[model samples]
Target: MLELGENPDTAYQKIKQLFVHLNLPERLWSLSPTTFSGGEKQRVNIARALSVDYPILLLDEPTSALDETNSKAVIQLLQERQAKGSALIGIFHDEHVKNQLCTRELTFGD
Candidate 1:
């Protein structure tokens, strides 16, 4: 939220949207993320990282903990960010996700 600079309202709205898209209960918004499940915490981490309007994004296995539905939502969000000109650098092992979001592929080592 602090990363949003002067626009907190926008941040709150985005957070709410993320919580919904990630299937997090609205009741948990005020609670500490430590109380969340592994997948829930992962969703929170993803939401927080994406809340900021950064020129560059770095993600490592962003959907590893999520189910197919939630993973698709995250992919959509990342695609929107990409369309808005954020350069995404990610390590995704899921071939479907990789194919959907990566415009260029780089492989190291066999």
Candidate 2:
């Protein structure tokens, strides 16, 4: 949050929004994410990343640990960011998510 030049209050608000969007419980906010479940921790990570404002985003399997609902929410957030002119470079095995978010496709080694 500080790294993004956001004040503490703004960071808190942004994190709170992400937490709500990702369905993370507010109780877990005061604790270390290491103690959370895999999906919970993943939500924390995603929230942290999305909380920052970046021109370009690089994500690897962003929804791998998320369920369908959470995945859809994340996709929606990413789409919103894309609409705002953020460039996303991601590796997603979920073809549906990839197709929804990507305007162009790139393939790697066969």
Candidate 3:
């Protein structure tokens, strides 16, 4: 298992492309950590995680930084991964994401 924090290097790209099958490569160096928008950074984070090619993934609030379109794309990506027999544990607050991605729900606190 791989734990990718923020600001991974560009060398992870090749592995990311192979497992996540993404056409877009993140331009991490183009923007400083402070200058990066939430969405862009989230994309980078996902790319870094995908680089490891793990069979199981746990994402905490994966799409929290994304806009609607990117959020949908991320959800679709997770579904595709699941179909490939990869287990994805996604934690989200967005009802849309939860409804679309999850077959069961577990809520903490009331």
Ranking by lDDT: 2, 1, 3
All models: lDDT?
Answer: 0.88, 0.88, 0.68
Give the poorly placed runs of model 1, Cα more than 4 Å off.
none
TM-score, per-candidate, Cα-based: 0.90, 0.92, 0.68
Tens-digit per-residue lDDT, 30-101, candidate 1: 998789888889889888888878899998999999999889888999999999999999998999999988
Number of clashes found in candidate 2: 0
**Candidate 1 local accuracy as lDDT?**
0.88
> Considering only N, C-alpha and C atoms within 3 Å, which residue pairs clash in candidate 3?
none
Better of 2 and 3 by TM-score: 2
Tens-digit lDDT string for candidate 3 (12-91): 55645532443334454555757766776676677666655579989898888777777777777778777878887778
Candidate 3, which segments miss by more than 4 Å at Cα? 1-34
- Please give me the total number of clashing residue pairs in predicted model 1: 0
